[model samples]
Target: MKKIAILLALSVALSAPAWAATKAVTLSISGMTCGVCPITVRTALQRVPGVEKVGIDEAKKQVTITYDYSKTNVQALTRATKDAGYPSSIKQGERDHG
Candidate 1:
């Protein structure tokens, strides 16, 4: 009986749903000339409910955003960047910096 109870508890633990963390995407932005640009991008992305973190590389002109996909998507993120005065695009490959 003890062995059967242990097996049942183990099965219950294994079947429990795991909490998934947010996923990140990097976007290549254009026309960011100064410090304010990164702030603008961060602000816009933060408006999304599940956006956990944002990192901007001014030299590379890229924004790395970690967000919950269940709450937002790539299009939404790109739009946020555009609305912030720094238009952006998803980096597809090794492309020229803009």
Candidate 2:
């Protein structure tokens, strides 16, 4: 019975999806001239498939996003913001934080 339980646990661990690895990044956004710009940016980012959380700082024109690394990437995040009419790039000196 113990052996069976151990095997079950191992199997469960192995079956976990790669998306279990999450990462956070901060981005500097441009063209955010008014209140509605943040709303648009948030909507666009949320539409991404693996975005787990989004924190926007309108006063600083920056946003922090926590996302599933296996399902999405920095390029995708930047593209989303660009498509929403707010271009974005990784904040200087900010590295990926998991």
Candidate 3:
């Protein structure tokens, strides 16, 4: 009976799809020198289907976004930012110096 229960549990676990991973991405944004810039970025990013959260740092000219990889990607996020008129790109590993 124990062996059967363990097998059933293992089968159930293996049948379930693993949850997607979330990644933190920083984007360099241009034309965000004013207060509205952050708002614009936040609104745009939130519209994305998989974006979990967004944070914009005006002083650093960076926008941090948390998203599920399966639903969205960096390229799509960057394009969304650009479409909002902020014009953004991935910050790579570190914050932008500009």
Candidate 4:
């Protein structure tokens, strides 16, 4: 029973990170009509909990965000942008970033 308990504890510890993993993805944003638009979008994404990094491409109307999956998800991201008056969507087929 002691060995079994030890193995179970080890397994739980190893799997914890996977459960709260980080994910990065590119989001297509709309309503960015000028140079200052990226700043607004960036602020919106940054306010989300677990958001680590934000990269904005005004020309492409896209923003890439890295965040902890356990704290936030794509829905939260989109909602933040929308609430900030810039609606966004996840770009299809764009895999998670490093």
Best by lDDT: 2
RMSD of every candidate to native, in Å, equals 5.8, 3.0, 5.0, 3.9
Please provide TM-scores, in order, for all candidate models, with all chains considered together: 0.72, 0.83, 0.74, 0.74
lDDT of 4 by residue, 1-98 (tens): 99999999999999987677788989988688899889988988898998989999888899999999888888899999999899888887776664
Q: Give the 10-residue window scoring lowest on summed lDDT in candidate 1.
A: 89-98
Superposed by TM-score, candidate 3 places the C-alpha of residue 48 at a distance from the truth, in angstroms, of 0.5
lDDT of 4: 0.88
Model 3 TM: 0.74
Q: Candidates 1 and 2: which is better by TM-score?
A: 2
Candidate 4 or 1, higher lDDT: 4
The 10-residue segment of model 2 with minimum total lDDT is: 10-19
Off by over 4 Å in 4: 1-20, 95-98
Candidate 3, residues 1-98, lDDT tens digits: the string is 99999999998899754555777788988679988889988999999988888887889898888888778888889889889998887786764221
Task: Give a tens-digit lDDT track for model 2, residues 1-98.
Answer: 99999999998888897429999999999688898998999999999999999999988899999999999999999999998888899999998789
Error of 4 at 51 (Å): 0.2
The model with the greater lDDT, 2 or 3, is 2
Off by over 4 Å in 3: 1-18, 92-98
Count of backbone clashes for each model? 0, 0, 0, 0
TM-score of 4: 0.74
